[model samples]
Each structure stands twice: as structure tokens, then as C-alpha cells.
Target: MPDATASILLLGATGQVGHELRCTLAPLGAVHTPGRAAVDLRVPDAIRRAVDEIGPDLIVNAAAYTDVDGAEDAPRRAAAINAEAPRVLAEAAQTTGAWLVHYSTDYVFDGTKRAPYTEDDAPNPINVYSRTKRDGEAAIQAVGGRHVILRTSWMYSRRRSNFVRTMLRLADDTDRLTVVDDQLGVPTWAGWLAEATTTICNSLLGAEGASKAGCYHLAGTGQTSWYGFARAVFAQFGRTDVAVEPVSSDAYDTAAPRPAYTVLDSSRARAAFDLPATTWTAQLDRFCERIGTEKGTPKAPFASV
Candidate 1:
């Protein structure tokens, strides 16, 4: 029982999560998704105007300042989109009596814990980008609107520029690829996230009502390092010629600090809603199928990080 008549507004409709959101929400009611030209997040007034125009029953924010390295230099810009913009949407949703569905990242954790992080775990961000996301989550809660904040990790899709696509492209050129094996988390597919969102929204629309509306961990089933994920991807693509070597995080020096273990516990989401559990390898296989390999392997340039 899907709500095909509820007016909905989707922000950040071009990004990874937003792109999938568009496809998932298409069967639902009149969905409005605006890009920067149509609705700029920096300007709260623009978001207000869009909300007024759409008068949506639900507002899904899938956009954020996702450039981890860039955020180190431009923390203000990151805060504006990731933190302030979410507050603006929450405010607008509250004013319109619409449910706010927001997406967050696993970077909120400092990666000190050995076990998987739960929704109850306190967030301790290690970088500027993560700090902004933490601020956004707080702002959304402070706005006091009916909301569902989904914190996911290692998200990828065939359409966007993510780890999965990057690895696939690199495999075609290089014989050996070195990826950091220290950091661990689930590799979530954008389509899985989109479909999960649709299921929750539909449940909310039905007579049963929303059983739970708060922060929930939504990602793939198993946990693995970036190197392990790359190896799995290569396995699915049938490209054994290329060897994915594991390296330490110290090998890759960047402006932003990545979480070493941001794996989240998703038992809550599964119990609340009838969500399907799919492994990262399974999803990666499907993704590889979508983006076919090159005719012949190209000689790769060996560039060390």
C-alpha cells in the first residue's frame, strides 16, 4: 500500500543517494526534486520558497557536502550545506507539518570502538566533514519534526563516482591495486538505500503508521576493509589478473581522517520494518554487471598515494 498521492519534495536529487531516491519515489505521488539551479541549499530562502511551492507531505534530503578532503579547507561551506541546510529543511517541514527524512554518514564516529556502532552510540567526529554531519543530525533533532535520520556508510552506485566505480575503472588499467585494509565498514548500494526508504515511507502512509522514526543504521550486511571490498569486486568482474594488495591507512595521507571502524548495527531497522538483508559482495556483483569491463586491460600508471 504505497501512497501515490502524497506530495513529496526531494533535495539533492543528482547525488548518489538522491539519484536512487528519484527512481524509488517515482511510483509514489507527485515528487519534486530540484538541483542547485532550482533550489540552492546555501540560501535558506530558496529552500523555503521551494517548500512553499511544493507543500509536500514529506521532505527527503539526500544531499550533503560530501567532499571529505575539501571540507578541511572549506569547513564553513560544509557546515552551511550539511548542518545549516538540514535545519532549514527541518524548520520548513515542521511549518508544513511534513515528515523529514534525512541521510547521514558513518563519519560521525571517531572509530575508537571495536564493536559495531549502534544508534545509541555518541558521535565523536574526527574531521570537518564529519563534524558538519554531526551538527546536521543535532539540528534535525532540535527542529522537533517527525523525522527519520538514516546514517549509512561506504555508499556506492553504478551512476555516481564512488569506491565501487573507481575500483572497477582502476582494475581495467592496473595489474596491482593497493587499497587501505585498516578501515572497516559495510558497503551499501544506493539502490538498497533508496528501496529501504521507499518501504519506510510507504509504511508510514499506510494504516499501521510509523512504528519507529529516529536514527537507524542502513548499510550492507557484512563488514570488510576497502582492500577486501576491492578484491571482492575484482572477483565478481572475473578479473583475477589484477591483484588487490592490502596496505595500511598510513600509506594514504590526506587532509581528512577516515574512520577506521564505522560499521553500524542494523538490527533496529530490520525489526522495525521488513527490510531485506543483502551482502556487499552480492550488491557489488550487480553493480559490476551494470558497468561492463573494458575489451582489453590497459597498462596502468603506478601512482603511489
Candidate 2:
């Protein structure tokens, strides 16, 4: 468990996982989440200055250039935030002897594997986003510091403009949706990721758990295609009027080539952290329940972003 007096510096506090981390890490220690204006990830000097100024015991980095399709056109920006920034942070953590917790994605793998990916699986990124994230993971490992890099997939949150929110927003007017069914992965909830991260961090802080520090596949249990995920979201919202059609990847024309199968095998994370696996459907139900309770109706659409 983390010491009560541990000072944690959290980057990307306003992002989906980062926002939830602020709440989950609160009871563990004091969490200082500086806005981008103070610790701009694009600038390496800014990152070094922030780490030096905060002098934190732990640094949880959740920020990244997450635009999968957009990265194809702007690879430099993605590399700056996802690759170089993490390298800088890892170096700083090495210097400070602080435990660094970083988030990665299943995109690191090319969807060629028949089964889910484990920590031992070699990464074969297919796009700019995945390549950059893979580079970040490598940089962190090369630093050889006390760090945990978690690779998750298809993350959605109530606040962010993610798959679930986008589906809800599109269902407002569209009656029929054509979703790709070829790509496969788990739809992880950001809140669940945050909570699991806290548990893992506590374990890492324990005496014997330091040896477990390494890259682990941390994601929601179960797997589904984009079409299946969209259907579940529509079902949760009781939007029977919106028809969801399953289509092959060939039908889509995205700038980036997403992996056809990237469902992460999180057995290592479960064994390491003693974390339970929750199915994606269960999480979706809970998210919908929260939305209903908060808005007093299940049909309350998120204001269009």
C-alpha cells in the first residue's frame, strides 16, 4: 500500500482515465494534477521542471496523443506527446527514484494473433499512434526505473467523447449505423481502469511487490467487435429505434489501419494485483445506470460535443 504521506503527481488530469485517477488516488495520498498550461507534455523541459518542482514520490502519467486516425496526418505531434514525453518522464523518475505509472494501449500489437496478447508477446504496431505508444513503452523499460506500464483498449467514459458517448450522440438522429465487426478488442471503462490502477499501485508499493514492476495487460474482461460493442451500448440506452449494422473493415476508410484483433490477456495483471475481471457488458450497464440516476432518465442524451 502507498504511504499515506506519499505525494503523487498525476499528468493529464482532465483526460478520461486521469480524471478518474484523481478521485481513486485521493485517499492514497495527496494528488497534484497540474493543467497542461503548467506541465505541457509537448515540451520536454516543462516535464522535467514539473517533476523537479513537485518532487513527488509517485508519478502517474495518463496523458497521450490518443487521436488514432489523426496521428496519420500529424505523426510528429503524436511522437512528441506519446514517445518523447514518456522518455523524459521515465528519465526524471529514474533521477528522483519515484515510482512511475504509465498507461499504454493494445494498439501496440498488430491484430494478427489468434489469442489475446500477453506481456511476452512482441509488439508489431501498424499505425502512427500504435508505433508511438510502443516506443513510449520501450523508452520506459530502457530507463530501468520502478515503473508499471499498463496496456488497455477501447476505453470509454461518460465525460469524454468516446465510443459510448459517440454512439449515444449519433443515435439521437440516426436510425441506422454501420459499425465495423472485423476489429476485435475489449471495451474498457476508464473508471474501472483507474480503480484497478490504484489497487496495482498499492501492491507495487508493498515490500515484495516491487519485483512485479513491469508492463502488464490491464483491460476489461471479455471481448467484442466494434459492432457488438455498439449494439450493447444501444441496448443499454434502450434505443431500439437505432439499427446497428455489422460491416467488414474493408467497408471503412480510416486513415489509420486498426488491428483486427487486440483483446489483451490480462491474466498477468490479475495474478499480480489480485484484481477481479469484470465483463464489458456489466460495466456498460453500470455506466448507463449512473447516467440514468444522474439525469433522471436513460434517454437523456449527452449534449453534442
Candidate 3:
């Protein structure tokens, strides 16, 4: 357990998840978030130096190479940041005797499961990103540090380029949008992920038992295909003006082969922490409202095609 007033070191503070984490961790005492200027994950020495300097009681690694398709062409670069850096961070955390919190992804699975995947599911990553993340997870465990690994999927936010924003933009430009209907998974909001991390940290601090550490799935409540998700996004914008046509994955072949079924079983997280599950539609609603307010545009469901 951490001290009643513990200091935390947070990495990847500029990314979507990291952005929310920075804000959420403020209530925790002395939370230190290093920007890319201060600590670059690409530099192992920098990561080592930052950990040594901060000497925090807890280290939350929100940093990762999240470019799914881009990783295919740049496997070595992805491996360095996604796999090697976490290994260094875990080692540093162990040397400093601090608890570590790392993030993984659903891509770790091959997406062959008919239902949601459990933690025990053997990881058969089909892409470079997943393979590197799996290696990172192994490195974390091998380092023998007190840690918690969260495997989440389809993460997006109102602040960045994501499905929600894409749908909104395309809806404004075209009357018909084609999306892959075969790929299925839950869309996780970065805000929710950050809030959940905060909850878990609080739970860990309150307890006196052994360090509550293990891999768990954290995603939205239900499942939907990308096509279904797009339709919902359009609905939220009051935009019946556009039609979301369902297309097969083959039609939109890309660099990275996406898993057809990436929906993760979040039962363990919900049961363990009693974490509330947010629906996909509700998340889209919140995102639309937030983005609309930010752009000073009308939050209409849809505009005429």
C-alpha cells in the first residue's frame, strides 16, 4: 500500500489517456507528470533518469506507441517505445520499490473468440502493436515489481482524432458513410479510463492486504461493430441526413490487420472494483456535446446532406 500521502509519477501526459490521467491524479498527493520535453519514452536513458529523479511511490505508465497501422511499417520504432521503454520503466520501478501501473490493449488477442475475452485468454496478437505490447507486459511481470496491468480497447476522446470526430466530420461532408460492420468491440472513453484508474488507486491505498495487482479488462459496457458505432454517432448529432452503410473489412484494407472481435470481457474489473460501465451511446452523446461546445457549432444530430 502507498503512504497516506504518496507521490506519483505519470508518463505520456500529453496523449488522450495521459491527459485525463494528469487531471484525475491531481487529488492524489504530489502527482508529477513529465512532458515529452522533460522525459521522452523513446530515450531509455531519459526514462531511467526521470524515474530516478522523481523516486515516486507509484509509477503509472500511460505512455505507449498507439499508432496501430503505422506500427506495421515501423515495427522497430514501435517495439522500442511500446515494449522496451516499459521494460526500462518496470525495472526502474522495481529498483525504487514503487508500485507500477501499466496499460495494455485488446489487440493482444487474435479476436477469434465468439464472446468477450477474459484475462486468461492466451494472447495471439495479429499485429506489430499487439505483439510489442504483449512483450511489454511480460517485461513488467518479469521485473518482479508490484504492478497492475489494464487491457483496454477502442479508446477515444473528444479532444483527438477518433471515430466520433471522424463520423461528425464526414457527416458534414457526405450523405453516405461506409464503415466496417464485421469488426466488433467496445469504445472506451479516456475520461472513464482515467476515472477508473483513480478508483483503483484509491482502493489500493485504502487496503492493508497484499498489493492488489493483476491484469484486468477495462472497456465500455456493451459491444458494437464500427458500422453500428458510426450510426450511433450520427444519431447523437441529430443527423439523420446521412446514411451509414455497412461494409466488410476487405473493402477498407489497411496496413494493420484489425481483429474481427476485439470485445473484451470486463466482468473482472466491474466485480473487483464495482466500476460503473458507460454505454456507447451515452459516451457519444457526451463527446458530441463537448466537441460541439468547443467548436461553437450547432450540436444538431445531422445536417442536410
Candidate 4:
């Protein structure tokens, strides 16, 4: 376990996972979350400066350029944040002797495998976003620092503008929802990720935990497609009146092509950290409960178009 007095430097404090990390890491140690004014990930020098200044015992990076389609138009911008920025952080961690905790995505895979992707699976990124992320992972490994890379998928939170929130908003404003069912992956809750990160951090900071430093899949247990996830979200809100149609990826025009399947096998993470597995439906239920309690009432059910 990490020392109770350890100082932690957390990047991307305003992001979905970052927002939750700030709260979850508090009990573990002092977490310094630098805003964009202090550390702009787009600027490599800023990241170096923040790392040097904080000189933390642990550095947890939760930031990334997550716009899959937007990345197709701006590959350089994506590389700067997803690849170059992480290289800088890893180097800093090496020099400062601080452990680095980084987050990755399941997009790194081509998703052709019939089963879930494991940590050892060779990455064959098909899109710019995934390629950049894959590069970032390689950079960290090449830096040879005490780091742990967590690969997750379909991340969502109540605060962020993610699929869950988008579906809720659409159900409130529209009637029919046509979602893509071809793509498949786990829908990981940011809250659960943050919590798991803390556990992983504690283990890494412990006496025998250093040897556990490597890549692992940290995501929700069960799997589902975009269409299935949308249906679950609507069901959570009692919005069965809405018609949810399943469509193939070819039905929609996009700048980038999504993977056909990217379900991650988190057995390594579970065995390593003794983390419990949770189904996507269970996680979604918890998320909905939180949203409902916060909002005080569910919006009207969506109707067929």
C-alpha cells in the first residue's frame, strides 16, 4: 500500500475519470490536480514543467484526446496529447523515481478476435486515435519506468457528455433512436475505474507490488454493443416508449472506422489486484440510480418516430 502521506500528481483533473480520481485518490494521499492553466497537455513543455515542479511520489494520467472521429481530421493534435505527452510524463517519472499510472483504450486492437483481448495481444490499431494510443503505450514501455497502463473501453460518467448522458438527453428530446450494433465492448464506469485505480496504486506502492508493474485490462466485466447499451440506458429511465433500432456501422457515415469487437478480458487485473468483476447492466443500474436521485425525476418516455 502507498504511504498515507504520499504526494500524488494527477493530470486531467476536469475529465471524466480525472474528476473521479481526484475524489478517490484523496484518501490515499495528497493529490495535486493542475488545471490547463498550469499544465496544458497540448503543450509538451507544460507537462514536463508540472512534473518537475510537483515531484510527486505517484503520477496518475487520466487525460487523452478522446474524439475518435475528430482525430481522423487532426492526427497531429491527437498524437501530441495521446503519444508525445505521455512520453514526457514517463520520462519525468523515471527521473523522479515516481510511479506512473496511465490509462489506455481498447481501440488499440483491430477487434477481429472471437474472444476478449488480453494484455499480451498484439495491438493492430486501425484508426488514428487507436494508433496514437498504441504509440503512447509503447512510449511508456520504452521509457522503462515504473508504470502501469490500464486499457479500458466505453468509459462513461454521469457528469461527462458520454453515450449514457447523450442517450438520456436524446430520449428526452427525440422519439426513435437508431444505434450501431456492430461494435462491441465493455461500458466502464469512471467511478469504478477510479476506485480500481486506487487499489492498483496501493498495490504498486506496496513492498512487493513493484514487480506487478505492466499493462492490464481494467474495465467493466460484461460486454455489449452500442445498440444494446443504448437500450439498457433507455430501459433504466423507463423510456420503453422509444423505438431503438439496431443498425450496422455502414449505415452511418463517419470519419473513422470503429472496431467490430474490443471486449477486454480483465482477469489479469482481477487476479493482480483482487478486484471484483461487475456486469455492465449492474453498473448502469447504479449509474441510473445516481442520476435519478440527483435529478429527482425521470423525463417522459421516448415515443416511436
> TM-scores across all candidates?
0.93, 0.96, 0.91, 0.95
Tens-digit lDDT track for model 1 on 189-266? 887789888888777656664556688888878899999988776666567888878999999889999989999898
Clashes of 1: 0
- Taking the tens digit of each residue's C-alpha lDDT, what string does model 3 give over 15-88? 78888988887776678988888888889999999989988878999988888999999999999988998899
Between prediction 1 and prediction 4, the one with superior TM-score is 4
Off by over 4 Å in 4: 1-3, 294-305
Worst 10 residues of 4 by lDDT: 296-305
lDDT of 3 at 286: 67
True lDDT of residue 119, candidate 2: 92
Q: Order of candidates by lDDT, top first?
A: 2, 4, 1, 3
A best-first ranking of the candidates according to their TM-score comes to 2, 4, 1, 3
Each candidate structure's count of clashing pairs: 0, 0, 6, 0
Displacement of residue 271 (Cα, Å) in model 1 is: 0.9
Best by lDDT: 2
User: Top TM-score: which candidate number?
Assistant: 2
Q: List the pairs of residues colliding in candidate 2.
A: none
- Scored against the true structure, residue 76 in model 1 reaches a CA lDDT of 93
Candidate scoring better on TM-score of 3 and 4: 4
Off by over 4 Å in 3: 1-4, 288-297, 300-305
TM-score of 1: 0.93
